[model samples]
Target: MAFESFSEFLAMGTHGPYVWSVYGITGVFLVGMVLQTLSAKKKQLKRLHSILVKDVSEREK
Candidate 1:
């Protein structure tokens, strides 16, 4: 199906709304998951670093 113009392509013969909505939702999910995973990793690393430092200080004492 050849679209006469860009707007026509977007309309997608009346299926555009559904198609575009699904794409938008999927994009949000992917971005949200990546951010959440990174945040969790950063927190874990910080906690581990503090624990290691405490252990080292105790050994010196």
Candidate 2:
């Protein structure tokens, strides 16, 4: 509503590139962090499961 037209909104009065780039960088960083967390969690669970299985086998012997 503040912008007179769609072009003006995209332009953002000469600040469009900076604003959009910040948004893009933030989005990429957030996605990367989420992916990293998921991967780490999966690895941790797998390691724990293996440890538990080994312990159970040792106890059985």
Candidate 3:
């Protein structure tokens, strides 16, 4: 193996923190984007449902 031990692997010869930090930041942003998309979709569906219900009620009157 290129690394003698687990610590050595993590250190990645002094570049570990930079490389790992980038990976961490990327993961956080990706997760945030997914959550935001799901939230927006739910909000839109609720709004659409309310509009449809109002239209239907008006027609029945």
TM-scores, one per candidate: 0.71, 0.65, 0.70
Please report, as a residue range, the 10-residue window in candidate 1 with the lowest summed lDDT: 1-10
Question: What RMSD does each model have against the real structure?
Answer: 2.2, 2.4, 2.1
* Segments in model 2 whose C-alpha atoms lie over 4 Å from true places: 4-6, 54-61
Candidate 2 lDDT for residue 46? 99
TM-score of 2: 0.65
Q: Identify the candidate with maximal TM-score.
A: 1
Question: Per-residue error at 25 for model 3, in Å?
Answer: 0.8
After superposition, the stretches of candidate 1 with alpha carbons farther than 4 Å from their true spots are 57-61
- 1-61 per-residue lDDT for model 1 (tens digits): 5889999989988999999999999999999999999999999999999999999999999
Please give the lDDT score at residue 9 for candidate 3: 90
lDDT of 2: 0.97
Which stretch of 10 consecutive residues in model 2 shows the poorest summed lDDT? 1-10
Query: lDDT of each structure?
Result: 0.97, 0.97, 0.98
Give the alpha carbon lDDT tens digit for every residue of 1-61 in model 2. 7899999988999999998899999999999999999999999999999999999999999
Each model's number of backbone clashes?
Answer: 0, 0, 0
**Candidate 3's residue-wise lDDT over 1-61, tens digit each?**
9999999999999999998999999999999999999999999999999999999999999
Task: List candidate 3 segments past 4 Å from native.
Answer: 1-4, 57-61
Best by lDDT: 3
